[model samples]
Target: MIEAVSLTKRYGNTVAVDNLSFSVKPGKVTGFLGPNGAGKSTTMRMALGLDNPTSGQIRIDGKIYQDLKYPLRKVGALVDPRWVHPNRSARAHLAWMARSNRIQAKRIDEVLDAVGLTAVAGKRVGGFSLGMSQRLGIASALLGDPEILMFDEPVNGLDPEGILWIRNLMHRLADEGRTVFVSSHLLSEMALTASELVVIGRGKLISQSTTDEFVARASDDAVRVRSPHLQRLRGALTDAGATVHEVDDAIIVSGMDSANIGETAAAHNVVLHELSPQQGSLEQAFMQITGDSVQYHSDLDEAPGQVLASGTN
Candidate 1:
């Protein structure tokens, strides 16, 4: 397991990571989430000992990363895929990392094949595409055959097939009782990949819980109702203090439950055709929970034509 206790980092007058604390347990994929410039990269770098924490510490298992006997053999990470020497072949890069950690040279081939880079193992990393470079980085992370793996944007340049491959690989590793922690901007993919989430904003811990719980807590309970007596039902729902939104042939009701909405319709003598509860998605939950936490806000409220017309003057 990976644990952090009051981890903090600073750069001159700027604070990159605050007194944050969280734990990632074994046998589960924990997603690290935050808006842009939220100190996620700094936190991950601190965990790997690449950046010194201003105060407190982050640990792999029970020991600091620098104190590990063979850090690579215990915790594997792919924070920056391009950290490799561009002049070296993919095979050579993995071989060098393996030697540093006393890993067997033959393990290089195994990981290369595991990441689907066996065919291009001899190619210079400088000429490889971003997707291929990502694969090589993944291969390097697996070179040590570590018990814990951490990846930052592992699927950044991957195609659909590659994305699915990495997703399944993380699951397989976690199933084997290894700790898997990853960070990504692909909220949809994270929803499908991570069973648990550690969300942060402005260098502080926002939430740490199972994926289902986080979504449920941030999302409101809403029901979509369709009735033949749409006008009467709308009035009745509004009178009952339910916020309603009309979309085509249906009305979305919030601040009330499905059973109560059905009862309200019945009491109003409204004939209902459909009544379905809407489940909140990960994207919706993230936006709602982290709305205020975003460091930069984009104003897309103005229509394109309106903005163009205003600019013409």
Candidate 2:
């Protein structure tokens, strides 16, 4: 497991991470989520000992990263896919890393094949496409077959197929009792890929829980009801202590489930055309939770004409 206790980082007057603490357990994928400049990268950097924390500590298992005998063999990370020698071939790059860490040279071929970069193993990294570069980075990270993996924006330049492949690979790693901690801006993909989530904003910890529990906490159990007798149904629902609102000719009932709404309508002799529960999506839940913490806010007050004029300018 990876654990952080009172973890904090400061760059002069600015605090990049503030009193953050969380644990990432093995046998499951934990998603690291936050808006831009929310200290996620800084936290990950501290975890790998790339940057020192201003106070507090982060540990892998029971020891700090520097205490490990062979750090790469215990933890593998792909923080920046582009952090490679431009002229070196994919194979050469991994070979050097494996050599420095005293890893077996044969393991290079295994990881290259695992990441689907075997065919381009000899190609210079400078000439590789973004997707290929990502694969190469992943290959290097897996060179030691580490028990813990950390990936930052792993799907940044991946195509749909590449994205799906990485998602499955993370799951497969966790299934083998490995710790998978990844950060991504793609909430939809995170929703499907991550079993647990650690959310932060403005350098402070906001939430850390199972994905389902976090989403459920922020979602409202609303029921959508549409009926020819809209007036009667609305009155009956409101009388039953449910909040009702009309939108696009449909009544949305909150604080009540679909079954209760349907039963109430039936007893009141109100005919319903539709009655369905509307569950909040992960994106919606994230937005609601992190709404106030967003550092950059876009101006939505501009008129269409103003937007067009500004674009031309």
Write down the TM-score of every candidate: 0.95, 0.92
* Candidate 2: clashing pairs of residues: none
User: What C-alpha lDDT do the candidate models reach, one value each?
Assistant: 0.92, 0.91
Off by over 4 Å in 2: 226-228, 239-241, 245-250, 272-274, 302-313
Candidate achieving the largest TM-score: 1
Per-residue alpha-carbon lDDT of candidate 1 for residues 103-186, written as tens digits (9 for 90 to 100): 999999899999999999898999999899899889988889899999999998999999999999999999999999999999
| Per-candidate clashes, comma-separated | 0, 0
RMSD in Å for candidate 2, one decimal?
3.4
Report the C-alpha displacement of residue 54, candidate 1, in angstroms.
0.5
Q: Candidate 2 — worst ten consecutive residues by lDDT sum?
A: 304-313
